[model samples]
Target: MERTRRSTIRSLAALGAAGLAGCLDGGLVGSVRERGGDGDESDESGDGDAPDEGRGPPTADGSRHLAYDLETLREESLSGGVGTDGIPSVENPTFVRIDEPTLIDDVPVFGVARGGEAKAYPQYVLVHHEIVNDVVGGDPVAVTYCPLTGTAQGFERGGTTFGVSGQLVNSNLIMYDRATGSWWPQMLATGIDGPMRGGTLREFRVVWTTLGEWRAAHPDSLIMTDETGYARRYENDPYGLYAPLGGYYADEETLFPPLSDPEEGHPKSVVVGARTADGAVAFDKASLLVERVLSGTLRPSDEPVIAVADPALSTGYVYLNPKNVTVEPDGDGYRVGGDGVGGAAESEGAVDADDLPLERVLAFDAMWFAWAGFYPETGFVGDHTGAGYGR
Candidate 1:
């Protein structure tokens, strides 16, 4: 996975009908070790204070807000003309490539879909994996991916401070084909759920290099979102019924902590979701909390939203969401490609409570990918590593 800082947000609006569990307090076996506790059978004790036991709302210091410039992050990767292959093309696209295509288990990865198409998920769409540990304050959160509501503009603290939470997840910016307005979703699941069917893969279209430019042009386009009413929303999903699609997982200690004050006494960055000695996987609780936003319980108006920042090159330590992204003079932030996304603009659409196709959409995640992975004749796993991975 591409290395970046760890940052995050908190919400549970995607669970729909699943009743918010109140503050995500279920402690994980990993959190305990990070807090100077035990990571083994001790977690089985079910102590209310366990890291896997979930946490309460954040405090004043724990909340944050974020904003960025637009032009700075906008780099047009596409030529000034349409593709020679007759496929759609966006102005100055910033395509994300997935290297080394093959079967993670058995599923064919192919390539990924850009932005703007029905069903955010497409065959071979690369995935981003982010593990959250700490936020602005000494709080914890988790990093999760969903394609339903689209990425939140940013996180907030104390109800007003907004923080950036896009880069690390890589699901924030979405692509839109200037030719066809069809919106294609990226595939989050890697393992072969089953064979690709006819219409199942038709919703996606291939676009040339320009993933970044497309996002810059259509600021309204959403990349990923959080879950708001997942339990009930996915209860009837065909994927969920046949093979469970979206859900939560708790791992070992957080490699990164998304610290509010990186310069202060903070933990160093580690590979996200990496396993430590003793066979335990490193992770963060803050990431899980942010993911709960898809639980149908979090609302857009919720106060003190939590978030993390993606460190440069998987340093592992997570920073507070607003703390990580340093917007440039133009109000935009910088990533590897110097592409920055402005604050999220409100999308004009009514939630289709009953029309969910993939279980992740119900959780509000955005999707995007490079054109190399969109070919109908291509197999899973091409030249990109983003496929089958999670952000």
Candidate 2:
């Protein structure tokens, strides 16, 4: 029976809604004593305090507001059926410099450029193992991806590592820090359960782009290899392909019901989302790239911000524009500051889209449904409603 299941995943052209849950099965997990159970790794108990910085993964100073009650999310969670560590994380990951002449140009990679250190984690490889624990720029970090939500994210792993909790909330991956057994949903990035409840992770940007584009931008970049010590086929994507946009990714139906049903936008359409202490906001990625710039405000607070597209990496960056500066696309970069904000004539300069003069807000790409599910109040900027932030 297991053999047939393995064959089905290995041979399927694209995954359907029903095949989503079973794709990670068919293989027995290794000894639990190796990594220990979720409880065995616990280092603290729930005390209504944040996890100690020295013992737990580093957390953000301020927690992002959650649209739902913590207890409500805990009750709504469902088991993914792949017990803890079933989809293991890549610890002591191996990497090699990606030089020219490689045939893997079109492959998609999650590129992270931190403090001049550039490294990429391939989608095909991460599809088998959702998390890769490695050090980038001398900081222990965890690079994560969720196939169901089509989201990729980065977090600082101070003294400990993270693993899959074998659970799903709003069709997103639930990551548990080994130090406190805190469950952090990838999209929310807040601890929903365990000793670290109410804690928020310090996040970094992970650019989603093709290998060829990344290599072109960062010539000295290194990419993770498929030597994760796990016995699995990395070539076969369990979900589907991103380039051709096939399989479960392109499907309109979600495997599980969403917590909040958004009235507008496709469930699978990609949106660049940002969250601050004030509130969360999302911009249509496709529109932002073409238009090169989109402006919106973080909810209730209504703090002004703008989304600038980086054509080089095929990603977008959100910047806080309290001054309401006008940022327009030049030849290849952006022209910022003029009589744009509040009708005030300000100093103008040319800057790269990724390196705007304003303060940048941490943002990442997420499926519309996942963003809406976790942040129902998120202000969406798209073609229908022109985001009139005075830009």
Candidate 3:
């Protein structure tokens, strides 16, 4: 597959003294040196601090892992081209209202909204700068995108900041925190190395959708501008066109092997997964497209979970099914209220008829192989069956 071929080429290109000289001229090695550092001087951890002690293997509840072991995580992955701060993060980024004639309608963007504040981060911009440290809804948030994994997520960083660690585990971007100098895998959201090892990050929902759909949902939303301090081609996508899902993203193979074997589903199939205190569940995107709404009970606790697919955004949200409300496709939005409240409009305001709002559980979208590799025993809620790891 194209993905494997790309990986082989990159691996071969990183070998030998001639390859080292070539890299020095310009390539992955040079890029890593240019970007690999303690980030800004202000954020540097010059003080001597020992790395965190290693822990036991990941739990069997599909919550954790022992992949490559924490001690060897840094050395296990490719290093030359993966440069820290190589893709400079946009600090205190500027945004314009959605009605402004800056961005086209069809361009793909990651949309996030909270406390009435909404913003869009374009894929073209994120493809270069994978991390954006910005404040939203009076909270410090980091908007991150991994082109290789096709994962876009929002993380609450408290008062600290995050930078690209110039590393990849399972072909996914690894991030480092400025305060603790700890390494965090983007999808896992846990610290694997340094002072903050075993710590978890608070995540927020980021809708992966086109600009047109986001604008319709949030007319008053703000869009990121090209006023970024760095100079580069904003119109050009280094990973290929994503609006139609072509290029590297469309391939069914991965650039690097994952720590755990991928046993179920296609390598590139998209799935919306949610993890609770008990276990994790993954809803197939293809199945969601057909059913619109899927309801199931998570393992170990039998806690009810609901997945509602939004075709307009090309994303799905997983929420705890506490109210037991049946969801159906209603015009542009969804009628999530009780049975009697048929086709109720969100503006009509009948969502609170039961005196309880739908509690949203944290969830994010990932490729099937990445998801299965991380949570091998995860339950599936669509056409695919649950096949435990190393099948």
Clash totals in order: 167, 0, 0
C-alpha lDDT score of every prediction, in listed order: 0.18, 0.74, 0.61
List runs of model 2 lying over 4 Å from the truth.
Answer: 1-54, 340-348, 383-391
Lowest lDDT block of 10, candidate 2: 34-43
Score candidate 1 by lDDT.
0.18
Ten contiguous residues minimizing lDDT sum, candidate 3: 17-26
Could you tell me how far off, in angstroms, the CA of residue 165 lies in candidate 3 after the best superposition? 0.5
lDDT of 1 by residue, 1-391 (tens): 2222211112221322111010111111211111111111111122222222222211111110111111111221111112221211111112222222221322211112232321111111222211111122232221222221112111111111111122211122222211222111222111011111000111111111122333333334332222221222212321111011232111111212211111211121111221111111212222322231111111112211121122211111211121122221111212221122333322123222211111110111121121101111111111122211233
TM-score of each: 0.18, 0.85, 0.73
Residue 237 miss distance in model 2 (angstroms)? 0.6
lDDT of 3 by residue, 278-322 (tens): 556788877886687888765434667788777766777776665
- Model 2 lDDT vs. the true structure? 0.74
